[model samples]
Target: MADTIISNHGSSEKGANPLPANSVIVVLGASGDLAKKKTFPALFGLYRYDLLPKNVKIVGYARSKIEEDDYKKRISAYIKVLDDKVKKQLEEFLSFNTYVSGQYDKDESFQVLTKHIEELEAGATEPHRLFYMALPPNVFTVVAQHLKRNSYPKNGGARIIIEKPFGHDLASSRELQTSLEPIWAEDEIFRIDHYLGKEMVKNILILRFGNEFLGASWNKNHISSVQITFKEPFGTEGRGGYFDQFGIIRDVMQNHLLQVLTMIAMERPVSFSAEDIRDEKVRVLRAMPIIDPKNVIIGQYDKSDDGTKPSYLDDETVPKDSRCATFAAIVTYIKNDRWDGVPFVLKAGKALDGAKVEVRVQFKDVTSGIFKDIPRNELVIRIQPSEAVYLKMNTKLPGLTTKTSVTELDLTYKNRFKDLHIPEAYESLILDAINGDHSNFVRDDELDASWKIFTPLLHYLDENTDIIPAKYPYGSRGPAFLDDFLASYGYVREQNGLYNWPHTSANGKL
Candidate 1:
C-alpha cells in the first residue's frame, strides 16, 4: 500500500492558535538543576530576544524556602551576561518574576500558588496559564492535577509542558498518559523531547523535502544505511545514582536518537501543520519492529586509558554488580515502503570520544565499475559545537592526471551563517509552547510507539544477569563490538586514512 495520511487528531481545526495574550508562564521545580540550568536560561534568552509574549508574566513555584532575592540569584546563576546592557536586561527579566514556596501535591499549597498567579494576572477577563514542569517524572501527574484543581485559569486556556524520560517502558508510559489525559487535553499538554528543537533536526524537513536531489534518493532504493550518533566525553561524575537506573538506552537512545530517526525517515506531512507532522512521526515509529538483542551491542565505560577520569563502576553511587550499559549501538529496521531492508543504526554513549550529536546517511556505492572501492557519498548533519551540513562525495583532483579524491560540499553554520543566533533547544521549545505550537513536541501515541520499541530489550537486560556488558575505556570510541555491530548491518565506513574533514586535528585529537 502506498503511504496515506494515517491520522489527524491533535491540530486545531481553526488553524494555528495565536500566542496567548494574557498568560502566566509558571515554572515548576524552579529551584532544581533542570530549571536553573535550562528552563530559566531559556526564558531569559527569550526575554533577551523579545520573543516572549507581550502580556506574559513568569511565575516560578517550588518547595525551596529561599527568600525572593536568593531564589532570583540562584536561578540567574547559570545565565551568561557579557556586559552592563545584558546585565540590566537580566535584572529586568527577573523583575516581574514571582517565586512561590509550595509542595506539588498539596491543595492548599496550590491555592496559595493560584493566589500568586492571580495577583500577577491582575484580573484579566480571560487568563491563559502555561505550567512548565521541570520536576521528576514521578511527581508529574500529581503536579498537573493540583494545578488543574486549584490554579486552573477561570474559564480560560491552560497548558502544561513536561519533559522526557517519559516512562520506563510502554506500560508505565501508557499509565502516565492515562492519568494526565483526564486533566489536560492532547493539545494542552506539550511533551518535550528537546532533540526536536535542535537546529539541524528541525532543518531535516527542509533539507529532505525542499531539495529534490535528496528527496529523490531518500529511500531504501538508493540509501544503504542511516546512523545517528550522540557521544559524550564525560562520565556520570557522581551523578551515577540516577544514571544507573536508566542507563544510556533509556537516557539517550530511546527518546533523543529515536526522535532524530523519525525526522530522517518519516513521510512528508500533508500541510506542515502540527498534527500532520506528528502523525507521520508516529507512523515511522509504528512501522519499526522491536529491537532484537542480536542487533545490539552494550557496554559500560571503564577508566580512561590515561587514568585521568574514573570508570562508571568507580562511582560510589553505582552498584558494584550493575550491568547497566553506558554505551549502546543498535541497528533497527523499518518495515515500510520507504525504508524496508535499510538499517537505521543508532549509536550513543558517555565517557568515550569527543562530545557530539550527528546523523550520517551513507548512500550505496556507485553502480559497479570505475569507481572501484571508492568512498560512498555520505550526508552528515552535525548538531552541536559548530553545527554543519556537509555532503562527502568522491571527486577528481583539481589537477594532475585526474586522480580521484574525496571532498565535501560543506555548509558549516559558524562559517556560513555568521550573523545568525541559533536559539538553544529549550528556548525554541518554550517559545513553541507559549505560542500553542505542538509541531516540535512529541505526541501521546509517539511516546507509546517509542517505548514499545525498547521495552522488551530493557526487560531482557533486567532479567538476564549473565549478560555482562562489554567494557571500553573512558574516552574511547565505544565497545570493541561496535565495528562488528555496524558490519553486520552492512554499514560502509569510509576507507581508513582516506580522508578527514577540513576541521579537526590531523593527529586525531578531537
Candidate 2:
C-alpha cells in the first residue's frame, strides 16, 4: 500500500512540516474522552500550524454508531481554534478526515478497517501508517493483537501508539509485551507517558546536558536529595470508583513521576536517539532499590466540614469499605554509585489544597564558612502552574551591614520568553508519535523495572487493612503525618509551609 492522498486542502506556509502529509494516522477508541478532548485537538493543532504533511488523513475507529459529519462536529466543538486563519486551516484539515465504526475484538471488523485504509491510500508515494490506541488498559492487549493479526499495513512504515496504565503489575506488563510481540516490532510500538511531553520536562535534558554549570553539580557528590511532587487540588470528582482501584502509586508515580525521576537521574546518553535515552532511563529504573514499607506513607481524603465536597468513599464509583489510598509518599533510594544513600522522595495526592509539579534538588552544605553563617544552595525545577527554573543561594542584603540572605536566580518562562506558546502535553506527545520520535515513550524493560519496585507495596496495601491509608480533609496540604514522615528522614519542612527542603545547603552543612 502506497501513501494515501485524502486531500490537499490546508496551507503549507506556517512552519516546517513535522510529518509528511501523506501519512495515515488511525486513532483507535475515537469516541472516548481522550480522543475527543486530546487526540483530535492535537491533530488539529498540527494541521493548523502546517506541521502535517500535504496529503495526510486521520481515520477514527470505535464501536460508536456515529456518522462522519457528526464526528467532525464533535471534533470541531472540542478543538480550540483561536483565530480566523487557524479556523480556516482546521476546515481544510477536516476535509481529509474519515471515521470507521467496528468492534475492536472482532477480526472481521478489523479486516474491514484494513480494507478501508487500503482504499484511502489509493495513489501516493511514501505511505506511512500510525495506529493509535487511546482506550483502557484492559483492551490494549486485545486491540494490539487484533491490529497485528488483521490491520497492519502490508506496505509503507507502520507504528502503534499506546496510552499509559500499561499494566497493573510487572507480570501483567510482561504479559502485555508477550501479546504485542508477535504483531509489532519493539521499535514500532510506542508506549506514551504524557509527562515526558511537557515543555519543562523536555527541558530537563537541555538544562543538565546543554549547560556546563548545572551539569557539573547534578551528581551525588554535590547534591543531597531530590524531590518530585504531583499535587491535585480537586478530589476524584465522583470518579473514585475507577481511581480508587489504582490509587496514586500506579496512577501517577509508576509512569509520570518515574519518567521525570529517570530523566533527572539517568546518565547523559551518547546521542538524542530514542533508544539511547530509553536505555539510560532503564538503567536508572533498574538500579532503584526496593522501597521499604517503613519509608512509604499512604492517605485518603476524609469528609469536609463545609458539606460541599464528597469524600472519597462517598463517590458512587468507590465502595463504602474501600481502603484505596488517594495520596502516597515514598522515600525511594537509587543504589547506583551516582545516587547511593540519597533519597528520591516522590509525593502525589488528590484533593490537596493546590496543584503543583516540581523537582527540588538540595545541594550539600558548604563545609567551612568565613561568614558567621552560610546559606545552603538549591535548584528548583517547576513543571506546572508555571514552567520555570530557579536557583537559591546566599547573597548580601541590599543596604545592609554584613547581612546575607537567601535569594533566587529566577528563570521564569512567562517572564523571560515573550509570545512563546507552550504546546499541550497531548499535542507534543501526539506529534512525537507521528514523527516516530520515541525518546519520550516507555520501553518494555523500563515498565517492568518500575512495576518490580512498586508492586510489592501495592500488594501489601491490598492484603493488609492494618496498613490502611490515613484520611485528610479536602483543601488541605495532605495527611498530618506527612511532616513526621519526612522529619524521620532528617528532612525539615520549609518556611513556605509546604513539605519541601531548601534547594541549597546553608552554612556548608547538609
Candidate 3:
C-alpha cells in the first residue's frame, strides 16, 4: 500500500524532503530513566532503520556529570545490539551522539550547551534543532525558557517535544502552556501523549474512516456505549510518591485515556490533515459536558485476598493518610447531535487483574421479540499486550438447533501479520517530530479543551478530603462497585456472552 497523503498544515509534501538536511536531535534530561530507557532506544531504532537524516547529530543534555564513555553506556543500555553487524551499527550510532551536563535553569549552562552544539554543527548553514524534554514537570518551563533564550537554532527551525503529567489540573496546565507559548510558537511545541503513538491507536483513524460499516454505525443511534480502559497488574511498589500526588485520574485518565476517547468519538475529518483531525477532536471535547462527581468512582487498593501483596498505603513512599485515588472510573457524555445520548466510560488504575489497554464500542441490542435479550454486537480494538481488532456478532450455534452464540471476526496482528515490526510508541512519535508531522502529536488547543473537560472534577476531588476512595483488594478487578458503575451507564452482559470463538489460524480462518 502506498503512503496515505497527509495535508495538515506544516506537514511535508509527498516525496519531498523526508528529513531536514542539517539537524541535531537533543534529549534533555539524558541522565534520567526515561531518556535512557525510551528516548535513546527509540533514536537508535530510527537510526537502525535508516529513518534519521543521514548527517544528523544526536546530543544528550542533563545535569548529571558523566564521562563520555559512561554516557554512551547509559544511553545504549536499553538498546539491543544483537549480532556483530548490529553491534557495529550501534557503535556507529553512538559515534554521532554526544553528551552535555548543565543546570536546567541556568543561562550560563545553556550558553555552554549552545556553544557545544555550534561546534558540532561545524559551519553548517541553517541547522535545525529538535529538543526533547524527558525531565519532570517542575523544570519544564524554566528549561524551555533557557533553551529559547540561549540555545535556539540560529537559522533552521526548532521543535520542542515534552511528555505528559502536563499539569496537576487545568490551571497549572494553562500556566505551563503560557510559559512555553511565549518562548515557542504553538507549532514549535509538540506535546507528547505517547498513547497516541501506539500502533493500533494510530490505526483508529484508518479503521473508522476507511470502513463504511464501522464508520456508519459509530454514533449514538447505532452504538450503545463506548469504553476506554487501562489496567495494570502491579502497584507503584516503592515509587508511590509521584503516583500519590496525581493519583490514577491525573496519571492516566486525564490525558491518555481522554485522548483515546477523543479518537474513538471524534467525527471524520474532511481530509487526513493534522489540523482537521485535531479540530474534530477539539469539537468533540467542547461538545461534551463536564464529568460529574456522581458519575465517577474512585478506589484505593488494599491488601490482596491471600494477604501476600501490600496495600497502596503500605508503600513506604506513599503518605499514610493520602486520599489519592489509585483507581478511577468516570462516565462522560457527549451533548452533540452525532452522539447525543451515548455514554463514554473511561477507566484506569494500578494493581488490577492484568495489564492491557483497549477501546470497546458496543452496538445497540437486536430490535426483535424472537431472541431472548440477545447480547449486543461489539467492536473491540486492543491497543497493547496484543494488537487486534475484533467484532463480536451473534451467530447461529453450530448445531441442528437454532440457538444463538457470539462469535468474533478477528484481526489479531500476530495472527494476520507474521514477522511484522510494530515500532515503539516513542519511536513513531520522535520520527513524527523530526519529520514535522503533528498528526499524532497533541496540539495546544486540543490540550486546553481536554483540561476544560476535567478541571472541575479534579478540583472537587482535591478539595473534599471527606470523599474517600472506596477500598478494593490489590490485584483484584478494581472496586466492587465496578459492575454497578458500568451498569448505571447501560453496560449489560448477556448470560450467553461467555462463549468464545475458536482461535483463527494465520490465514484468519478457523
Candidate 4:
C-alpha cells in the first residue's frame, strides 16, 4: 500500500493506494464483445507494459462454455503482437489468466467462480478483488449481488467496474442504482465513461487549470459558444439491433460528450482528488435544466448518394419503421457565474465526413477596429484518431501589405512526441480501476445528474412518433439544419482553408 501502481503513460491518479500485492482482476462477461475487444486487450496492454502488479491473477467469467484454448484465442485476438517481446508477453499473460463459466444471477455459479478465485489466492497474505462488469445493463445488478455475496475477498477490499448504458433514462438509471447501493458502497463502484480516459479528454483539466493564460480567460466574458462533437465516418454496418434500442443521444451525446462538456465548463476543483473532481462536475450539471426541445435537432442518415454504403434502415437487424435519430445536435446552457450565457453545443453522428471527437471553444470576435471580418479565436481539443490541441488566431500574412489570415498554434501529439505510446481509453480506465482512482470514473450522483439533463428530451423522442428526424446523405457532414441549428445558438464557422491539422503539424505555417 505504500507504493502506487503507476500508469505506463502519465496519469493524474497520484493520490490512490497501490494495488494490493495479492489481487485478482475478474472479468464477469469475458466471452462477450466488450471483454474480447476492450477488456482483455486492455489487461493485455497493462501486462505488456508491466503496469499490473506482479502477483495479480486474472479471472474470466461467463455463461458460455468455451474451452480454455478457444477462450484464450478469442480474448487475445484483438491484442496485436507488435514484436517478439510482445509475443512472449502475450504467452506469459495468457498463463497468468484463467476463465470460469458461470451464471450472472445464480449463487451456485458464482460459488464455482469464488472457488476458482480462492484457489488462485491460496498463498496470498491479503487478497483483494476487482470485478469488471462487462455484461449488459439488464444483468448488472444481479451480477453485482452475486459477486458481492460469493466472490468478494474475505479480508481484503473489493471493487466493481461497471460499463455504460447505465440505464435508458433517469428512472431506469435510478432503478439500476437502487439494486447496486445495497450490495456495494459508492467508493467500491467505478462507473466507467471511457471518454474520460482519452488522452486529450484527461488533458482538458491541466489545459484549463494548470496554465494561467487559459485559466484566466475560461469564462463567459472571453468565450462565446462551446461545441463538443463526436463524429464517426462509418455507419453501424448491419449492427443496429442494440444501436436501435439506444439512439445517438444515449449512445454518445448524453454520457461521453456531456462528460467532456463538464471538464470544459466546470470550475477549478478544490483539489485534484477524485471526490473533489467529481463534485465539481456534479455542481456544473446541477446548474442546468433539461434541454429544451426547441434547442435540439435530430437526424437519421440516408444512403450515400452513390450505390455503395447502406442507410440506417438498410441494416436487416434494424426495425423497418425505426425513427431513432442517428445524429443529434443540442444547445444547452449552464446557469452559473462563469458560464451563465455561453452556449454548449453537443453534436454527435454515426456516418459523417470524418471520424473524431473534439471540443471547440469559440471566443468572441475582436473589436472590428483594423481587422474587420477577421475570424474569432477558437481553442480546439481533438480527442481521438490523432490527439492534438490548437488555437486558431488571426495572424499577418508574411510579406503582405497588412493582410490577415487565420493560423493555428498547434500541438499535434504525433508530431511533437514521436513514437510515444498513448494508451487506449480502456487501458487508461482499467489502470485507474486497478489503482483505486475514481477521478475518471462516474459516481452514482454524477450519473444521475447527467441522466436528468437528457431524460425529458429522450422521453419526448420516444413518446412522439409523428416526429421524423430530418434526412442527411451518408458520408456527408450532417443534416442541412445542422448549420442553422448551430447558427441559432450564435455559432459562426471559421473560413475554409484557414486551418487544417496536417498543414499545421507538417510545418509551422498554416
* Model 1 accuracy (lDDT, Cα): 0.88
Higher-TM-score candidate of 1 and 3: 1
Candidate 1 ranges with C-alpha deviation above 4 Å: 1-14, 503-510
Q: Give a tens-digit lDDT track for model 3, residues 329-427.
A: 999999998899888999998899999999988898888889877888888899988899999877776668887667789989887776668999999
Instruction: Report every candidate's CA lDDT.
Output: 0.88, 0.82, 0.87, 0.88
| Model 2 C-alpha lDDT per residue in residues 289-382, reported as the tens digit of each score | 7778888999999877587777898888899988888999999988988888888889999988898999988887778757643656778899
Better of 1 and 2 by TM-score: 1
Per-residue lDDT tens digits for candidate 1, residues 325-406, read 9999988999999999999999999997899999999999888776678878899999886899999887776656756777
Cα distance off (Å), candidate 2, residue 320: 0.4
Error of 2 at 188 (Å): 0.7
Count of residue pairs whose backbone atoms collide, per candidate: 0, 19, 0, 0
Clashes of 1: 0
Quote each prediction's TM-score. 0.95, 0.91, 0.95, 0.95
Q: Where in model 4 is the C-alpha error above 4 Å?
A: 1-15, 496-510
Candidate 4 colliding pairs: none
Which pairs, if any, clash in model 1? none
